[model samples]
Target chain A: MSTTLERPALRTSRKVPPSKDSRTLLKSQIRTGWALLAPALLHSGIFIVIPVVAVLVLSLTNYSFGDTWAWVGFGNYADLFGDVDFLASLWHTVLYAIVVIPISMAISLAVALGLNQKIRGLSFFRTAFYIPTVTATVAVATIWLWIYNPGSGLANGFLSLFGFAPNRWLADPATALPSLMVVGIWQGLGTKVIIYLAALQGVSRDLLESSEIDGANRWQKFANVTWPAIGPVQFFVLITSIVGTFQVFDLVYVMTQGGPGSETRVLVMDIYQNAFQDLKLGYASAETVIMMIVIALFIGVGRLLQKADAND
Target chain B: MRRGVGLTLLAAALSVLVSSCGNGVIEKSTDGVPPAEATGTLRVLLPSFPPSTKGKEAFQKVVDDFHKTYPKMKVEPDFATYKNLNEKMSTSIAAGIPYDVMVTGVGWVQPFASKNIFEDLGKYGVTPDVIKEKSTPALIPAVTYDKKLYAYPLIADARAVALRKSAFREAGLDPSKPPKSLAELKVAAEKLTKRDKNGNITRSGFDLASATGFRQSFTTFLASTGTPLYVGGEPNFDNKAGLDTLLWIKSMINNVQPYGQTNAAQQPLVLTGEAAMGIVNGGVDCSADGIGQKNCDDLEFFRFDSGKEIEYVGGDLASIGSRSRHKDAAWGFIQTLTKPTTLDAIAKLNKKIPAYKDASNSPQAKSNPLSQFVADGLVYAVNENEVPSNWLEMRGNFDIQLTQAVLGQKDPAKVLHNLAGQSR
Candidate 1:
């Protein structure tokens, strides 16, 4: 009885003061953790954090990659708001995101569901779907450019087979943005499909079986079990999709160059033109800040939706 | 500990920002030429030479020739393309390592000269009279900014209208007498245009090429009307001539040609037989491998004659950087570049006419009929230079806004007005 009471006291003493070895081990673990993280942390600090800060500082000035620059304190921001070209680019980017995100997400999810089932040539289908993601955007865009050629392209040829008139897919102002959106969707599908495939595979098989036992139909099984289980992944995909569509540059740059009267001029392309072409670095930085904020707001809304979904 | 790390990172970032804010103004050096024995590297930024093995070998010969003059000076070449030339130059300027010499294009002098990036070649005895005596006199205006010669011409890129003799004959027009005026050309084009049963253009009568081509076509037509797009950094086309030119272009779109169509190879539509007639560039190949001699013989080139007969001329120009320590060496290098043998090789490589008085006699010009025609036309060439310093920025805006006007999305008058406003 006395020994047992001593054991309790000893345990209390041990809790009060961790041994020197334990303390050293804890400290060493933290040191190891920080050591492993240092390269990435340093990279982020230098490339991301520093550039963002520099851009913020530049947005307040009239820096045009020249020697002399004067501080204008939000003047660039004011100018950006009034700039018609920039406003159009913003609207184009927003419209692109709105059209691209939901459709791409739905199509990819459907593809992911179909591929998730035990099927023949599963690996081949998976690789085929992921090939576009790995292909260089420039190469893809060039191929698409050929495919959109009015006279000899596959797109028009396919349309001709359907007894439809040949459309100037990228050349017409009416069709240019939509044509780009199609390329954007097709190019983005692979990554989203891969992500959804992974998330779908992670959905609890036991939960799905239980839903089926409860007389749940196919749609009901997906709605109750798979969808809820993949809610976090859905949020992740939404945020990524929003960011990706918002920052689209190379595709449009190669394809149309924001031609046909700036019909396909997206935000990043406008920023690039302002910064590099017009030599208006400060104004471009302000545009970049606005773009970042817009993307953040979209992600925030996505987060809210995910939280509400979780509550439900 | 984390707070300390955060503070350290913040301080580091702020320091970087502060350092970047340092005044990047480079002091112009008017010092006399470096001695022939100077050993430092003489860096050159040029888009004139193709970055290919053959191009490099040809450029190396030029460098070897320069080495004969300055045997000790090492040469560094940055063969950037025209599309990325501005980016490379701006980055170099920001980095405080501006090239010793830069090769740019026509209409680039004013913008770069305004920024004091180029050294006034006047100090080195490059006067308008000297250029007229030694080079194509018309390019003198292109190299002059604020009455100072900022660049020396390297080659001439002239555009002339070409028509297929067969197409002309088929349309019941005289094959020898190509359309000389804009009005005549429009009529000829309408007649030559071929359409399918569904009313889609099977063959464009006049290929404006695409939206990008429209911008150049506008310059070609506007200059023929005795007015340039811009004069001394201001809009010269905001009046009647500009409106008429734009209206003419708008009228042609989807009438004589499709809105934005080009052949599969992106070659001149006339050359590819995609269009009956179009504005052709300085050079064409009539070899067995190219358009072939028989087909080439069936084409005729002509200049636009409205208020004046003129061809749109643009060219690569060599200039010394203001901050160059070896201005003398740079000038010597440019002189060698302008030599007949070197210029001929560069012209051949670039498919341009040598910007010299005797350009028509250059080997490349003598071999290609189209090139020879362009070289002969260089005498009456009018370029898109002598414009405002903001012309480079205006070029892009012109392409987009002009497209809007041509597509009938915006009124032609308002488009010109807005472009004029933007140029300011």
Candidate 2:
């Protein structure tokens, strides 16, 4: 009976009229919440929202960074389907994302797992893996260009050690995209590894021990405990990687310029060529719109998978 | 109320964007010119000189000379690269602050002029005849659009083929009698090509120097066939000469020289001894600091003569912006840019030949044999000029489609047809 008397109220009175001071305090809290959010809201509105709206509106017109513009409502979009360059770029970008995302994720996870173990020179190895992520894309591409040099590149030199024929890595259309994919995977590994490393470190050790006591093997321990524990992080990595691989430009621009007969041409490269090179700003904006929609769809699919995993 | 405010803000933003896009058309300049005593800043965009310390110093010297004429006028330079010049120009124009003076390349005049981005230099007494008398007559058609001079010639960037005397002698071919026709060139290249035990190209017979694309080489070869890539903005390469030129380039790839091959440094293979012969740029450095005088002595330059003995020539040209209020000062600045000493300094810094009629006598040309050869060949220069307003766009298409043909990924005829359709 004393405990019942001492218990705090679990709910506010439904029909009570608040005191002036209480109402003012609530209003002040609301104001503080808004004040905390204002900067980020303002930044998003100016940078992201405004540009997206501008691009959407511009996509309906034939504006070429010139004085005169005429609205041809969806004509640019209609022409985009028929444009061979646009279609090719879209296919290349999608193919790049499909090939790069899973391989990069798996490789990064394996590396993260290796680095997570007790080892000598662990910090050194970790830094070595993470360095590429921090390096500038242009600088990385330049170094890779040297590495892919046909006659004297490190790649050819390595091939010669095994008595294999030298390959024109970036200059050959058959190998250009694959060579770029290797760079893309290697460059993107560092960040994903770091993320996965953090997630692997956070996997509950007690749960792993319990699984082991239950006669679980290493594979079972990982499948049941570690993998599920890193589910949210895996979702995050997948979505971000999908978005990143879709927007790859600087590497391709510096390395091949989407060359060897447009073999490495990606969506962003095509959009850039249209906007800045061809001076077709409106058509490029339409390309941008389609790219955004595709990225959104990818993210949506990722969300559905996350939900399914949670249900399981 | 929050939703209402959000909608209102978006509406305001859209209105602002729409209104901003409406006003970017540059207005024609009024006849009245600003006085020489003008005090405002003159914004100049130049891709002519690089943005290096040496480039800036050379450009600053010209600016100082301009200040001598108009001491009160301030000059702000945007030293952009040719790759980024179009981007900078488009953004500046959209922002309603177009540069007062713009220095661009050969094929850029028509595209910019069609949009009225450039002022008609004829109003300031820069006619075709004036250009012919003062500069290389070959560049007149390059700077002219609709029978009016839109730009003044700055520097001529020429391409000529060079061969090694030692390599020719080893092949038992006369070095002095360079191949004049494509057929002779093919036969000579086949003999000069060297192979390793693995059937790899140890030394290329003829380096196209086309790691990027065959467009420039195609242009040079096409001009030798007595046809330009485009004329009056129409596709002129859809004929027999075009097909033959594409076939010739394809047949040579991976036979004499590898497709899309370049030295590690991306320098011309002829200079690096990776090839017996190759197309070289306007100038070669023969100083001890460069490829060395010994290597230079082994080289001899020649022009292609299929139907015409034509060398590919491109150049940088300066123009006044139509929207510039400081047209007279801009014109004055352009005059200082074209002075003999200034032209020589810029040509030396850029490793290009001055577009002046007497450029062969310039110290930069006299010191470099390749520059001298290019300067003398300016008379027989054929440039990708007098093209349609969409030449810039067409050039990119040509680069990619031509690459496809050279790589054997596409049929030459189909590619030509596709390119012609794009031009239309």
TM-scores for every candidate against the unseen true structure: 0.92, 0.93
For model 2, residues B133-205, the per-residue Cα lDDT tens digits are 9998998888988888899999999889999999999999999999978788999999999999999999999
Candidate closest to the true structure, highest TM-score:
2
lDDT tens readout by residue for model 1, B1-424 = 2122223223433443554667433433434645565667788999988999999999999999999988878889999998888767765765656798999988788877877889999988999998888888888877888899999999888888889999999989997988877898899999999999999999889987564536778888888888887777678889999899999999999999988776656689999888999888888889998899998998899889988999889999999998787788889889989998898999899889988878888898898889988888886798775777777777788888899999988898998998899885
Which residue segments of model 2 deviate by more than 4 Å?
A1-19, B1-36
Candidate 1 chain A: 10-residue stretch with minimal lDDT: A4-13
What's the fnat for candidate 2, on a 0 to 1 scale?
A: 0.36
| DockQ score, prediction 2 | 0.32
Model 1 residue B6 CA deviation (Å) reads 24
* Candidate 2 lDDT by residue in tens digits, A1-312: 354457777586787888999999999999999999999999898766886798888789887755567998999999999988899899999999999999999999999999999999999999999999899888899899889988889999999999999999988999999999999999999999999999999999899999999999989998999999999999999999988888888888889999988999888888778877777778888898898899999899889989999889
Docking class of 1: acceptable
List RMSD in Å for every model shown. 5.0, 4.6
Candidate 2 TM-score versus the reference: 0.93
lDDT of 1: 0.84
All candidates: TM-score of chain A: 0.92, 0.94
